[model samples]
Target chain A: MMEEGVKKFLYVNRKAPYGTIYALEALEVVLIGAAFDQDVSLAFLDDGVFQLTRDQNTDGVGVKNFSPTFRALGDYDVNKLYVERESLEERGLTADDLQEIVYEDEDDDWAEKPSIRIISRAEMADLMHDQDVILSF
Target chain B: MSTLHTVNKSPFATQSLLSCINHVKDGDAILLIEDGVYGAAAGTGVSDAVAGKAGSVKFYVLGPDLEARGIPATRLLEGVEVVDYAGFVGLAVEHDRAQAWL
Candidate 1:
């Protein structure tokens, strides 16, 4: 549970979603944190950027793929999704390269989509200092 | 010139401990926190590896974590300081940088 009046919760995601539980766990944490009405932001770096990549397929692995769950975040009131610019460039992906975000029509996801900023790792690290609770998953 | 390296997981858990120690400089302080605290009570294997890693780094552990985990202060390796959270924060603010090995 989050503390009262804790505005800033920085969630750092540093692993590939498919390979491990790190990304799924991180996404779950952020949604839960937002449900508690805390100010939350997510930073995707390292292999974590892959979690938002285009067309994630887990069917061949004989398990549920969680890529689509990210589309449900807006419904859960999670709006602050950030991606490191350098990470995308390194992975040869851009905003257009991402999968079609299937969010609810006529929802806050539109207004929130414009606020999804791209930043550098250094910028992300500096932002960590101001967060009330910093969790790296 | 004191640095505390905090190692929480069992030695075999991950490569975080070795990776963290590899990057630490001499005279740095290392504090064992969370799962890293378990490393201190394990055995000489950790000490030998840490000594090799500590070019000049010192060792410290959070007293709260140790006690909560049922690991006694006396059971810790030589030259390891048993301190609290205030001490841990002091180290982070005192030192030039802090890197978590988890």
Candidate 2:
């Protein structure tokens, strides 16, 4: 259950994963913040949208493929994953190119629902403005 | 409700500190961590820029990061406050939000 006075927390990701530690470190903060039962939402823009792309193989780079970890965020009740529409288009990707992360809606007899929400840049900006705490990575 | 800006890179190495200082508003607090602690030292090229903002913006450095980098508290700039991890958490809670300049 969400506690009283749960603030809207938004994590803005603008960098590509693997090239820097920002994406991974930002994921760590999201997972930790889940325990507080805050209104958590993640926004992927710029190269950050690459983090959700499918078939990410890190074997060549000799690093662990942490992309799969994003799939598990739904289990922690963190399901508001927003991907900017323009970001995906600029990178030559579509919703079909990304992983399908879903969550079981307990309020509706455990029906599966999509967690990733593809929104426009203006909508993403509005979401950012609505947040009480914005964490950028 | 001031924003807490965290910089994790050295001024000599990256422009993260400079960019953070440029964007921070009045009453915003800046915390230097990791290699960023180097910016808190006195008499550096970046010191003058930091000093100019001392009146409006507050400056802080991570104590553990400074120690790990062999920077003593005495070497820090006059307005720079050294904070431990606990103090780091306090600043996050004290401010309205935190922006990490990675």
Candidate 3:
């Protein structure tokens, strides 16, 4: 179990939503952590960018769209969502491209809210440096 | 920096194994977990690649997975350690970061 107050986990979701169970499983871990009130953050990269993309067509594949579930993070008090800038550019997505509220730059502290942050690779390295726990799914 | 990479599938069957072999620095320990345990077989394709990674990376297998698969780590190349699940956590604790190649 993560120690109280010092419990910090950076859950990096790096897989597309439909490819496997990783995306959903990652979300499960986040929700569980939040239920325990642990400090948690999320980062997206690589094909994981697909999880946040708009106009997902999971219907054709006979699966439910999970991209919208991310919107509920704010309600669950789990809102530190970060997307890699390079990954965004490679996919032609800016922070504005995301349909939900998210940051275009790193902001570890946002007034009355969790950071919903964005960052570059170097910043990600820094984020990793401070994290007591990190899980990539 | 230390890295404990958990590979969930076969070396040749999935991209995860290739990614680990390519990115893991020399001296970094690579723990085979899930289906990755299948790679410990000597003379198999994965063992051949693991053998090639000798100086660059070290191979370890989660003991339960190995036992479930019925392959002993001693049968593996000289250096591989048969670690338990708790040891797996210890590895994650000991390493600076973990990259799951799934």
Name the best candidate (by DockQ).
Answer: 2
- The positional error of residue B100 in candidate 3, measured at the CA in angstroms, is 4.1
Please give the lDDT score at residue B94 for candidate 2.
94
Q: What are the per-residue Cα lDDT tens digits for candidate 3 across B1-102?
A: 666778878766765665467556656788888788877778776666778886677788888887887887667766677888788889888887786766
Tell me the tens digit of each residue's lDDT in model 2 across B1-102: 678889998999876787567656778899999999999999999999999988899999999999998998888899999899999999999987777877
Misplaced by over 4 Å in model 1 are A1-4, A100-112, B1-101
- The per-residue C-alpha lDDT of model 1 at residue A110 equals 56
**1 or 3, which is superior by DockQ?**
3
| Location of the lowest summed lDDT over 10 successive residues in candidate 1 chain A | A106-115
Residue A59 in model 3: shift from native, Å?
4.5
Distance (Å) between predicted and true CA of B92, model 3?
Answer: 5.6
- Give the best candidate by TM-score: 3
lDDT tens digits, residue span A1-137, model 1: 55767677778776778778878888877777666777777777656778887777887898678888877776776656777777788778787766555334355545535325677755654555445565767
The residue-level lDDT of candidate 1 at A20 comes to 81
Steric clash pairs (candidate 2): none
Report the Cα lDDT for residue A94, model 2. 99
Candidate 3 yields a Cα-based lDDT of: 0.73
The alpha-carbon interface RMSD of model 2 comes to 5.1
Global lDDT of each candidate:
0.68, 0.87, 0.73
Winner on TM-score (1 vs 2): 2
